[model samples]
Target: MTADRQAVTQVLSGLAEIRPWYQDLYRHLHANPELSMAEYATAERIATELRNTPGADDAEITTGIGNTGVTAVLRNGDEPCVLIRADMDALPVREATGLGYASTATGTSPDGSSVPVMHACGHDSHVTCQLAAYRLLAAHRDTWSGTLIALFQPAEEAFDGAQTMADDNLADRIPKPDVALAQHVLPGAAGTVMISPGPIMAACDDMFITVHGKGGHGSAPHETVDPVVLTAAIVMRLQTIVSREVDPNDVAVITVGRMEAGTKNNIIPDTAEIELTVRTYDERVRTRTLDAIHRVVRAEALASGAPEPEIRFLSRLPLTTNDPAVTEQVRQAFTAHFGEDRTRPKEREAGSEDFGIIPDLFGTPYCYWCFGAHDPAGWYAAEAAGTAGSDFPDCHSPYFAPLLDALDTGVEAMVVAALAWLGTDRA
Candidate 1:
């Protein structure tokens, strides 16, 4: 490793002092989870935490930037500005982790329906580590000269807040960045880092489809056009899209996450609703997959003599491609702090992130990495004992939870990365 890279270790050490405070803050955010665009209390809590931290002295904090989003800027001089981003939104999943801090909070969805909320995606950890980095960035102003743009964006789970912030002229409000960086917690040995070049995550789209039909008594199948049977056929056909239509070399995942239909077993419902999420690495594959979905739904409905199916797109995010050079720089920085074995290449995930949009708005380099949140030994022990519940869970699972080690390791890696790239031009 280069001497410059070795020196970054000191940055991690200096920032390690704030890890305890943020660890406590992470539990608070996790317990009081909120949904996308409804992160009012979450944002307020973030603002309060920042006010009590080191950066609060010189930071410029703004709230409701994109309907509950917060942005804090701390500038030391004329050097290049680095924007570190974190998302603040919880999923509509009931708590199953059974942790003492597991959320019992519920949020109101866009449709005005009550839904259970949980930090299944670890945004809570991301926000807490972000606060730790902010405090250190302010305390170590002499170690680097530049502006630090700490973006606590909202609704990332919905894949629209980054764009919404842009629509609201986010770049106009704060000092634009020289480079952008962010991270998430994924399944791995605790304290390990994972990143890759090119496409780090898939482009994703959520679609809502409703098959309409005439309602009738279930006893007389001939008397009714069965939308439930039609929906089943449509769901099965949607699965074939990846195997038969998409190229073998390219990857695609189409998951029907939700299905709702009849209220009674004896009554044939007039309509059945389905919610699906599609993921692809290439734009061409994504377009083809979407087209295939529409064709399948419409054709299946037509075959059942159902009314025109209603198809509504819920949300979308372009593929997240990390700048190769910037990613490698952090990879080395991570290796420097945690050793070469602790930092490794992570296979690109089928899941998506809205962070990709930030680089386009600022026209700067960005790298989004994931650190493992679970204990390595415990994860292995569970696997060996054939105990699934005791295993490390994936993000978005109702039972997903990361260990306390995530708080310190995340902050250390983030602090070193920000310090390493703070005042330099993107190569």
Candidate 2:
């Protein structure tokens, strides 16, 4: 191995020493997950851990950046600065993983509803991996010299946590990084890395639509202009936007995930509510798709002789495009560390993320990659049988839980990637 590779391997060897502490930390986080912008306890716990870690004692830690976000800065000497990010918020999904540490925690959602909160997206693993990586790097300062920023962000599920930090003068708070890096837990085999050059994830928009109508007794159908019927018609018509309107060559998705109407069977409600999401890869396609949705919704309401429908957008996430040069650097590092079989080119994902917002604010190049944390045997079996999609629980699912071994994989991947920029060659 070369000098830099040898240094990275020596640093990673410390993983065996720190593994137990981080595993316990992951369990604690998984059990006591908090909602978006409400991660007060989570932020405090992370800060406390940083203060208590031996080599990280000299680090300067800051809390409450954008509310419930935490940052720990470790500056060893004059070297390239690298910002490593991990989201801290949990989703409003109830846990069903049946693990001993499964979350029974609850939190108030954005809509002020009491919902079950779980780390169904492997954010618990994200935080654990980042913390372990920081600990390893801090302890082995002699191996690599540079400034490292570990950012624990909040409200990623709401898709605005990064933006919230930027709005709160994040540029004034932390050191501007030469490069920003982030990673997510995917549902593939554990310890493997997945990466691509550009547009790895899609841009997404969430919309809330309400159609107004006349309420009446269930027995008096003629007196009521039913909004439930109007909403159903609108949903059906909205499907045509992708098929009949958008080009088949391009990709776009319009999904009406939720609809709320009357509570009682005997009464017709005055209004019907629809919560839908739009996903697209291209800006022009996104604009056109959104325009088509507006036209269809209004036209359907008019055809149903209902009042003008109310439409509001929320939780807009930008396309996660990887910087080509930055991505190639990280890809090389991953291949060297994880070997050829474990490091493979990734296909573009339809999922959306707000990570791009942070690097964009500073105008720095950034690369976001995914690491698998699933059972390797099971994942491969499912893939062989063409049952991967149905067998493996996805990020938002209640049953989604990464294997324990993923902690080692994530920490090593992060350390290797960070060392790519903060290597001894630069020192």
Candidate with best lDDT? 2
Across 282-350, the per-residue lDDT of candidate 1 in tens digits comes to: 989989999999999999988999889999989888898888898888887787778987787978878
Task: Write candidate 2's Cα lDDT for 110-163 as tens digits.
Answer: 778899999988888999999999988888888888799999999898888999
For model 2, the superposed segments whose C-alpha errors exceed 4 Å read: 108-115, 210-234, 258-273, 298-310
Superposed by TM-score, candidate 2 places the C-alpha of residue 233 at a distance from the truth, in angstroms, of: 5.5
For candidate 2, what's the RMSD? 3.3
Best by TM-score: 2
**Candidate 2 similarity to native, TM-score:** 0.87
Residue pair clashes in candidate 2: none
RMSD of each: 4.0, 3.3
Compared with the true structure, all predictions reach lDDT values of 0.85, 0.90
Whole-model lDDT, model 2: 0.90
